[model samples]
Target: MAGMCCGFVGEGDSSANSRPSRRRNLDMLPFKYIADMTVAPSGTSRKRRQADLSGKKDFESCEGSNGDRGNEKSKKNKNESSKVSENKPSTEGNLEDGEFPKFGVTSVCGRRRDMEDSVSVQTSFYEELFHFFGVFDGHGCSHVATMCKERLHEILKEQINESQENFEWNSTMQQGFARMDDEVQRWNSSSQTVTCRCELQTPHCDAVGSTAVVAVVTPDKIIVSNCGDSRAVLCRNGVAIPLSFDHKPDRPDELIRVEAAGGRVIYWDGPRVLGVLAMSRAIGDNYLKPYVISEPEVTVTERRVEDECLILASDGLWDVVSNETACGVVRMCLKAHMMTSPAESPANNEVTTDGSDQACSDASILLTKLALARHSSDNVSVVVIDLRKDQRPTSNSNYNLIN
Candidate 1:
C-alpha cells in the first residue's frame, strides 16, 4: 500500500504564498479493500476538520455508553435550571432596571411625622431620554400620595392616547391633573373610611389630600403639572424656570373656588381659604374636594436645549430655600462641585458631607440634606431629573438615555 504524506516548510518556501493546483492522486487497491485520502498542509488540518464536521456529532458512542451519559445529561439539565432560577430579576432589579415592572426609587421618612410623601420615575419605551419624575406630598394621611405613586403614569398615558389631536401642552397638563384628582377621589370613595379619634390627629376618613408635581420629559418638550403647594422648577443656564405656580388660597381664582364650594376663606391672621388650608386646589382633603375638582391653571413652555435640569419637590424644600438658591445648589450638584447637604442645621451653620455631584446620582438624597440644613419642619421629598443627561433629544428613532 502507498501512503499519502503531507508536510509544510516555513520561511523560504515558494508554495507559501502560491495556491496549489488541483490534481487527483490515487493508490490502486482491490475493489473490496478500496480507500480514499486527501493531503493538506499541517497548518490547514484543523481548519479542514472543522469545516467538514460543522453539524455532525458523535451520538453513536454516547448511545452505546448510555450509563454515564444519562447521569451527565441529567446533571447538566439540573445546573441549567438552577442558573435560570438564579437569574430571575429581584424586586429591587425591577425598580432600578425599568423593566416591565419598573423600579429605582429611594425614600426616607426623615426626622418627622409619618413619611406621607412618595416619589417615582417611569420610562415606558426604554428610551433613556424619555422619562417621567413625580413628587406627591400627602396631608392628613398617605392615601393620596400612595395612589398617585401607583397610577399617575397610567392616567397620563390614557389621556394622551385618547386625544385625537396633537396634545396642546397646557390642555394635556390640565387634563392630567384633573384625571389624577378624580382617580384619587374614586379610590377613596370605594375604600372603607378610617377615622381618627384624637383631636390633634387629622380625621382619618374625613379629608386626606396631597399636592402633586409631575414632570414629563418627551423628545421635543418637557411638561410640568402641579396642584397645591408642591412645585416643579427647571434649572436652565443656572436660572430657575418656574414650571408651575403655587396655588395659594389667597389667590383670587383660588378664593373664588373656596367661597363657591360653601367654604369661606377666613383670614384671621392672614387670608384663609377654607379656614386653615393654605392651598385652594389640591388632591384629596374631602372637605376641599368641591374646590379641588376645578381644573388646575396649566402653564406650558417649549423646552430649550439649555434647560439643564429639573427639580420636582414638595414645599418642604421650597419653604427653606429660595428659587435662586435651589437653582444654585442643583447647578453645583450637577457640576460635581460641593454644596451643603439640606440635612444640615442652618441655625447652627452646621455642614453635612454627604452631598453628591454625580450627574446620574439621585437628587432626593441631596435634597433631603438641604431640607435638613434649612430646618424645614415638614417632611421633605424631591425628584430631580438631570435633563441635559437624562432626557436629551436624539436624531435616532429609538429612545436612549444620554450618557
Candidate 2:
C-alpha cells in the first residue's frame, strides 16, 4: 500500500504548553451546548451569585420561547449534558449506521495525563462476513496513534486493490502492517520535528511512538497483528485464546536487532530486556529505532463456531486486569444480549460490519472502566469484537481464506 503524502511540520513550539488551551476548547463546547438550551436569568436575580459561583449559569441563557418552563427544562438539560460529556465514546472513529447488530460501547478516560490515546475502527464491506477492529496505544506521544487512526484502513484498502486474487489474508495483513511502518518512517523523515499540532513546534521528537494491536475477523478465521506490548485475546466457549504475543527486548532476535541498530540491550542486575522497556518490538520511539524498530509479529488462526469474543487492549488495561478477567467481562456481555444482524445474511459469509455499528460498543466501554478502576497509570483503550454472529449459519455456506 502507498503511504499518504507527508504534510509539512509547521513552526516549532512545545505541545505541552499548548495542551491546556486545546482542552479548554473541548470543555467549553459542551458548556455552550448546554447554555443554548436554557433561558437567561435577569441581572437582578437572587440566584445570580449562586449560578455564577457554580458556573452553571453559563447554560441558563439557553432557555428559549417557553420562558420559566424552558428554564426548568434547561436545568434538566444541563445535568444530562454533563453526564454525556463525562461519558464519551470509547472508540475514535465515526460510527456506521445499520451495518451490524447494535451494541452499546462507552469509554471513560482513566486517571492519566491525557484524555485518551486509544482508537478503534469498524467498517462494513463485501456485501457483512468480515469485520475489522484495531486498538492503538500511544505511549511517549500521540503522533503514531493519530497516524494509525487516519491511515490504517486506507492502507488495507490499497492492499486489497493491488491484490486482485481472492483471500490472500496473511499476505494482505502483513503487507498492510509493513506499509503502516513505512508510512511512519516517511512521516518522521519529512518533518523537521515531530509534532501533533501543525501550529506547534518542539525540539524533542524522540519521545513520540505507540503500540498497535489489530484484529480482522472473517467468517472462517480471525487474523491478529501486533507490535509492542498491546495484546489481543480471543474467547472461545468461554476459554481465553491468546492471539498475539508481546515483543520484548529479551527475545534473542529482538536483542540482536537492538544491538545491530547500535543500541545496547543493557542487562543490569535483572534479566529484564534492555534494563528499561520490557517490550522488544513497537511502532514508535525514534530514540529506540537504533536498538529496536516497530516491526509487528503477526499471527493468523482459523475461527471456531464456539469462538465467542475477542479483546484488544493496551498495557494499561492488561496491567490492571488479567487476561482471564477481561475475557470474563466480554463473555458476560455477549450472553446478556441476542445477536441480530442489521442486514440480510449473505449466501456466503462474505459480508462484514463496520466498527461503529454499536454491536459490541457497550462491552468496550465497560472494559475501559474496569481498567480505570484498577488504577492504571497509563492511557487505557480497549476494543471488543463479538464473533457469535459468525457462528450462526445462513442459507450460504462458510469458506475460509488462506494463502
Candidate 3:
C-alpha cells in the first residue's frame, strides 16, 4: 500500500503506532500545554492555498505588504466594518464549498518518508456563524486518521444535536469521542475502507489509532476538544494561549492514570503506553483498552477583541517550533499585510467565497517553511483562523502540502 499525501505509512511498516517521542522538556503555554514535543498542526483541505514550504526562499510579499515590526502598531489602529457574510472553508478531501472558508491552512510531508495526517473544516456547521475545524494524525496506518477526517465532526455534531441540553460542550465532546471510537471499531471489523497496509487484520483493526484536536467556533466562543497529541492554540493580544493540553504518556497525570489502569509507560525512544503508543489517549487503539481511552479533554473560552488567530496543528510543526515563535511569525504576517487586506466585516449573514486572505496565506506558508527549516521529520499541517472581527486581519489563513 502506498502512503497517502496527507498521512504517511511505509509500504509495509506497521511501527507507526510507536512513533518516536521527540521531547521530554516541552515548553509550557499559558494554558499549561505540555510542549516538550511538537504535535502535528492539523486542519483541512489541500486544494486551498497549497504551497511547498520546503524551498529555501522566503514567500513572495503580498500586495501592500511590508516587513519590519515598526509599522504594525500604526497599521493596527485602523479598523473597518463590512457587510459580507461568513463563508465556508475548503475541504481536506474531495470537498468543494464553492469558495474559501476564510481560514488559512498548510500541511506537508516533510523529511518523513510517507504521509498520514488528515484535516477537516466546515463553516456554519450547526447554526449560522458556528464552525468546525480539526486535524488528525494517524498511527499504524493512514485509515484511522483518514477515518477521523471523514466522520469525527459529524459524530460530534450528532452528539450535540442529540443532547437534551444541546450546548453542554464538555459532556457532548466526551460522548462524541466515545462514539467515534466505536465507529472506527465497527467499520474496521467488517471492511477495509482504503487499501491500507493493515489489511483490516487484527480484531476491529485494533492495531490502528489516531490523535485528534478539534475546535468549534461560534459568534461568541471558542470550544476546543482534544485527544492524543494534536493541539489547538489561541493567539490573544500577542500571547500564545493553549486551548488543549497534550496527553503524552510521560505527563504526570497521564502516567498516573496509565499505572492505575495497570498499563506501563515504556521508554521506547521516549515514552510509550506499554511500549506501544506514545500518547495516553486517542480516538482509537482499542488494544490498549482502559489505558488508552478515547475521552477528550475539552476547553471553552470567550472570544475577545484582541484575539489575533487560532492555530491547530499536529506535533510535526510543534516538535520543532515553540508556541511563542509560531505566534510571533503569524502576528508579523498579519501586521505586514494589515493595510492591503483589512479584517473581514462581521456583518455578513450567508456565506460567499474566493480564497484565503493574503496575510493568513502568507502566515501558513511561512510556518510550514519554518518547520521544514528546523528539520521536522514528520508530516506538518496547520490551520490559521483570523479571529479579529470588526477589525479583521485578512479574514483567514489556510494551506496544505503533503507527499
Candidate 4:
C-alpha cells in the first residue's frame, strides 16, 4: 500500500471573510483555462500509483498544482487565440482512446488574498474497491483543510473496516470527522510557524476551521459526508440531486441545532454562528467548542443508469452558481464534447495528463471561470466525475497515472 497525494491546494484558497466581494474580471473577460493542473487516469483497479515525492513504496500520493493570477492572466492571453488551450499529456500517463476522464479538477484564488481550498481524488481506493473525491474549504487558515486532505480518507477507511458489512453511514462518518477534528485541534494547539494571512495568535488560531464535503463512489453507491458549507451534487438524468447540503448557520435545522447547543446565530452582514463563522458545523474551530460541532450529515445514494456526473465543489462556486445551473453547464459541455471536435470543444479547456475526456475538464474550468466572473469572493475548487457507465473504462484496461 502506498501513501496518497490525491489532494491539491491553490495558493489563493479560502478567505474567512464573510462579506461578498464585488470584484469583477473586467480585463480577464471570457476566461480560458489557466489552471495549473496535473490530471491522471482512473482506469484499472489494482495498479500502484506513481510516486509523487521522494518517499517509500508504502507512501500516499499527494499532488499540488500551483497557478498564480498573474500567470493565469498571461497564459490566458496566449491561449485566447485557440478556442481550447491544451497541455501535453505526461509521457507515462495512459488512457484508452475515447475513455471518459475519470475526474477533472480546477482550483483558483479568485478574489481572495491567500489560498485555503483543497481537493482530493483517489481512484479504486480499496480492494473490491471504490473511488474517492473530496473538497475542503479552509477558513482562518489552510492547515485544517490540508490535514483533512492528508488524513480524512485514511480515517474513513478505518471506520469502514470497523463497520464492515453493516456500515453505519452516520456513525462511520461521525467517527471519521471526530478523529480528524481531534487531530486538527492538537495541531492548532502546538506552536508552529504561521503561513496564512490571518496572523492570529495560538488562542485566536484555535478559531480556525474548514468546511469538508467528501464523496465515496463505489461500484453501485455514492456516499457523501459533509460538514460546513462545501457541497456534493449528483447529476442524474440531467437533474441535480444534492447529495450533501451546506451547513450554514441560517438553515432552519442548523439554526435550531446551534441554539439548542447553546450557540447563537447573529447576522453580522450574513447569518453566522455567534456572529462569527458562517457555517454551523466544521472540522476545527476548537474555540467554538460544543456549539460549532464536527458531526457530518451523511447521504448514501445508489448509482443509477441515468447518472450523468457527480460534482463536488467549494462554496466559492456554489455561492454564485446554483446546482441546477452547474449541472446544466456540465450537461451542455458533455453534449458539446460528443458533438464537437477537440479543437473546437470549448473556450476554456485544459488538457489533462492522459488526454482525458475534455468534457469533465471543460466543465470544471468553465465553472471556476464563471465563479470568478460573477465575483465569487472566495477560492474556487471543483471536481467533475463522469458517471455515464458507457464512458468508464472496461475491466481489462490497466492505465497507470503519472504525477
Candidate 5:
C-alpha cells in the first residue's frame, strides 16, 4: 500500500452484523465483544482476529446534482404571480426545477491501482428538498464500498422516518451505522460477494472494508456521520468547520480504545491497528471485529444563513488539501459562476454546457483533479454541495461567523 501521510497546511495547503444476539445499546452506540487475542494466520486480511464474538455483532453493511441547493431557494423565492409550474423546468431559467442543493461529484482510480472507492448522491429521499451525500474509500476490495454506496442511505432514510415521531438525529445516525455494518458483514460471508476489478494486482476479497463519511442536509440542519477517515466539512462564512471526526488508530481516543480491546497500534509504514488496517473503525473486515469497531460518531449542526457549502470526501482529497484551501477554492468557483452569469435564472434540470457555469457544475470533478495533481496516492472521490443561495459574497471581508 502507498504511504498516506497526514499534514495540515496554513491557509494554503496542502455495521452490523448478522448472526447471534448480543447485548447492544442503540442509545449510546456501545460495542462489546468477547476477548480473544490470538493473531490471525499468515495471509489473512487481518493479522489478528478475536474468537467467538459475543456481546456485540460482527461488521457488516448496509446501504447528486448541483444547482440543487441554489435552484430550490430560487423556487421558494419566485414571484407569487409568476406562471412557472412547480413540476417542470422554466424555459428562461439557468437551473432545472428542484435541483437545489446542487451537487458536483467525481472519482478516479489511483495510479496503477484498483479503484475500490465509491461515491453516492441522493436527493429528495424524505422531502423534496432533502439531500444525502457520501464518499467511501475501500481497502482490500471495492465490494464493501459498493454495498454501502447502494444501501446505506436507504437504511438511513428508513431510520430517519422512524425517528420523525421522536426526532433524535444523533441516535438515529448511530443506529443506522450499526445496522448497516451488520448487513455488510452478512454479505461478505454470503455467496453473492464477487471479486472486484483490480489494476494494481493487490489483494482483493470480501474480507475487505471501507471508510465512510455521510452528510444529510435538511432544511434546518446538516447531520454528518462518519466511520474511518473519510470526512465531512462545512464551509460556513468562508471557514471550514469539521462536522465529523476521523477514526484513525493513532488518535488519542482511538489508541486508548484499541489498547483496551487488546489490540496494538503498530507503525509499520504508518500507525495501523494490529499492523494492518489504518482506521480504528469501519464497515466489514470481519477479521478485525471486536478491535476495530463499526460505531460511527455523529454530529448534528443547525443550518445557518452564513453557511456557504458542505464538502464530503475521501482521504484522497483531504490528505492533500487543507480545509481552508478547499473552502477557498470552492468559494472562488461559485463566485466566478455568479459573476459570469448574474442574470442566469433557475431552470428545470438544465445542464450547463460550457464556461464557468459548467465548471461550477463540475465542482467535485475539479476538486478530485486538484488532489490528483498534488499526488494523492489513494483512489480519489469528492462530492461538493452548494449550500448557499441568493448570491455570492462580494468579498472575503463579508465572511463572518453566524453567531
Candidate 6:
C-alpha cells in the first residue's frame, strides 16, 4: 500500500570536442521469474496441489549431522543476502556521485497485489564503470524475483569471465540466464530436501516466478536481455527504439515453441501456457518448465551521440505508457532543465542537479507517477538512464530530439 521513489544521476566531464561519452542509462524495468523457478508439484491443478502436499512426507526426519545443518545455514545466509540487496534503496542522499558516469534509477510499487516486486541497480559489480539495472516482478510470490535480483548479475559476470577469448556478448547473455535458472533450480531442490527449520517462514515460494528485463551499460555498448513481459526502450534522437520484446504466450514464435514442448496454449484471460502461466518465458514456475523458458532474448546496440535516454520498466508502466509518450516526457524535462539556468556555468562538465540533473531525476519520478495515474493493475517500476553525457542546454534546447 505504501510506495517510495529514489533517483540517482551519474555525472562526469562533458566535452563537446571529445568523442561521444560512453554514458547510457540502462533502465531494467520490472521482471517476472523463470517458468521453472520453484514449482509446487500441482501447479496446474488446485485440487492436485492439496492432494500432493498432503500426501508428501516431511523431510525434517532426513536431517543428519551438524555439517548438513551448516549447509542449511549457509543457504539461508545466501537467501538473506539476496533479499537485502534487492530491497536496498538507491536514495539520492546515499549516492556517492562517484568518478564514473552511471544511471539514475527510480521505482514505485503499484497498488497491485501486495507488491510482489523487486528492483536493483548495481554500479559496483565488476569494474565500477560497468553498471547493471533491473526490475523483477514476482507472480504467485516474490521469491524467484528476489533470488534473480541478488544473483543474476554475478552469474552473468562469472559466465563472461569463463568464456574468455570466445566471449560473444549475445551468447554470454543467453548462457548467463540459463545458468541463473539452473542455480535457482538447485536452490529450490536443496530447500525442499534439506529440511531447514530456519526457513519455515519463507514467503512467496509457491509456484511463483518472475520476468526479467536487464540492461548492462559497458564502455562501448548497451546489452539488454529480456525474459517474459518486461521491456527496455532506448530514446534515440527522441524516437523510441525498443531494445527488448515482451514474451507473451500468444506471440507466434512463442506459441509454436510451447506447443512443440507438448504444452497447450489456451485463452484464459490472455493466452496462457497449458492455461496456467500467462507468459511464454520466465525465470521460475516449475510446472511450466520446458514450456515457459528462461532463455533471454538479447540486444547489443552501440551508444550514439543523439541517444537521449533509456527507459526500462515492468509491463505496468508499458501497459499504460506508450514508448513514444514516455520518451517525449523525458526529453522535454531534460531540455527544460538544461535551458532553465543558462546564466549559471556548469562546474567541470557535470550536469548539476541544480539544473539538468534535478530535471532528469524528476523526469524519472514522473514516469513512475504516470504509470500509477494510469491505474496499471500490475506492479510499476522504472529506471531512466541519461545518455547525453555532456550536452548542456543551449539556445537549441527546443530542437527535436532526433535529426
lDDT of 4 by residue, 1-403 (tens): 0000011122232333332332233233222222333323466221222111101111111122221000011111223322221221111111221122245677775555556777776544443235567788888777788788878888887776566355466788889999999988887777776665553445537867888998876645678999988899998887899999888788999989899989998876567778777788999888887889999999988777788889999988888899999998888776656555445643223433343446666778788878776767676788888776433223324432111
Whole-model lDDT values for every prediction: 0.49, 0.51, 0.62, 0.64, 0.62, 0.58
Model 4 residue runs over 4 Å out of place are 1-101, 192-199, 341-355, 391-403
Candidate 3: Cα lDDT at 105: 65
- TM-scores for every predicted model: 0.60, 0.61, 0.70, 0.72, 0.71, 0.68
| The candidate that achieves the highest TM-score relative to the unseen native structure | 4
What is candidate 1's CA lDDT for residue 101?
13
Q: In angstroms, give how far residue 283 of model 5 lies from its true place.
A: 0.6
lDDT of 1 by residue, 115-213 (tens): 566665554312222355677777666667767777777777666556555546567667877777777667656755544221124433436677778
lDDT per residue as tens, model 6, 270-380: 567776676788887765788889999999887766777887888878878999999988887676656555456332244343222355456666777777677555656
**Which candidate should be chosen as best, given lDDT against the real structure?**
4
Order candidates by lDDT, high to low. Answer: 4, 3, 5, 6, 2, 1
Model 2 Cα lDDT, one tens digit per residue, 1-403: 0000011121111132466764564354331101011212456221111100001122311111000000001112323323322222111112221223222223333433343254544433221223456667665456777778667766876676576445465677678877887777777667455435421233444445667887765545567888877889988877888898866566777667777776666554322334544566666555555565666677887766677777877776777788888888776654433333325322122322221323355466667667655545455566666655433323334322111
lDDT of 6 at 375: 51
Which 10-residue span in candidate 5 carries the lowest summed lDDT?
A: 7-16
lDDT-best of 2 and 3? 3
Candidates 1 and 3 compared by lDDT, better number: 3
- The TM-score of candidate 6 is 0.68
Better of 5 and 6 by TM-score: 5
> Could you tell me which 10 consecutive residues in candidate 2 have the lowest summed lDDT?
64-73
Candidate order by TM-score, decreasing, is 4, 5, 3, 6, 2, 1
State the weakest 10-residue window (summed lDDT) of model 3: 29-38
- Models, CA RMSD each: 31.7, 17.1, 12.6, 13.6, 16.5, 18.6
